[model samples]
Target: MPAAALKNKPLPTQSTAKRSVLFDSPYAPMAKHRLPAGRPREWYVTHNRRLKAMRLAIALLDSGVYLANQAHDETIRSTAEEIGVHPPSNTTCHMVRALMRYSR
Candidate 1:
């Protein structure tokens, strides 16, 4: 992908084809954090900070502050720790990788 290719694209909309593709593919897995059996019906809080952290990580990597393969895990771990969110482990990384592949 070229830098120019992404330069003028509008921000993605929720109903975009990419989202449809995600929902239709194997990348769309069940949520890991579901209410247990017999649990009261309650809304789970959205962790907006997690998305922020991911965006930050992506930005830093794009800016050449960190190599994609080198220090990526540690950077994610440290950033998550700073934000008090548990860092995703290898399993989560694998899922993310699959999702990225599907999106591309």
Candidate 2:
């Protein structure tokens, strides 16, 4: 089976009515205010990149390698330090230490 077919498979039906008080209220007509514009916000791009870096850092840390040996380690650290508003937590520091030992 192809991926598209699997996704199109019928879902089980529920017996109860799927209703929301928000939709039934007079405010429903003005709910357009709740919808987001279909464009990426600046913060979204920044946050997404930060999340990607963090994930990569965690993977490196898990592999038990020194970050300095990795091609992108310096870039990751520089970007993280620049973008990060606060210092990493104790857990994050511990993970970095483990990676350092592994690299050695």
lDDT of each: 0.40, 0.39
Tens-place lDDT digits, model 2, residues 1-104: 88875664333233121211111111111122332557568766555445444543543444333354442434334323433323444444444444454545
Once fitted onto the true fold, the runs of candidate 2 whose alpha carbons sit more than 4 angstroms away are 1-40, 73-104
Best by lDDT: 1
List the lowest-lDDT window of 10 residues for candidate 2.
Answer: 20-29
For model 2 the local lDDT of residue 86 reads 35
Model 1, 1-104: lDDT tens digits are 98886765343233212111111111222245644455434322224333444543543344334444433455445433433355667544443334333432
- Clashes per prediction? 0, 1
State the number of backbone clashes in model 1: 0
lDDT of 1: 0.40
| RMSD in order of candidates | 13.0, 19.7
Model 2: how far residue 79 lies from native, Å: 18
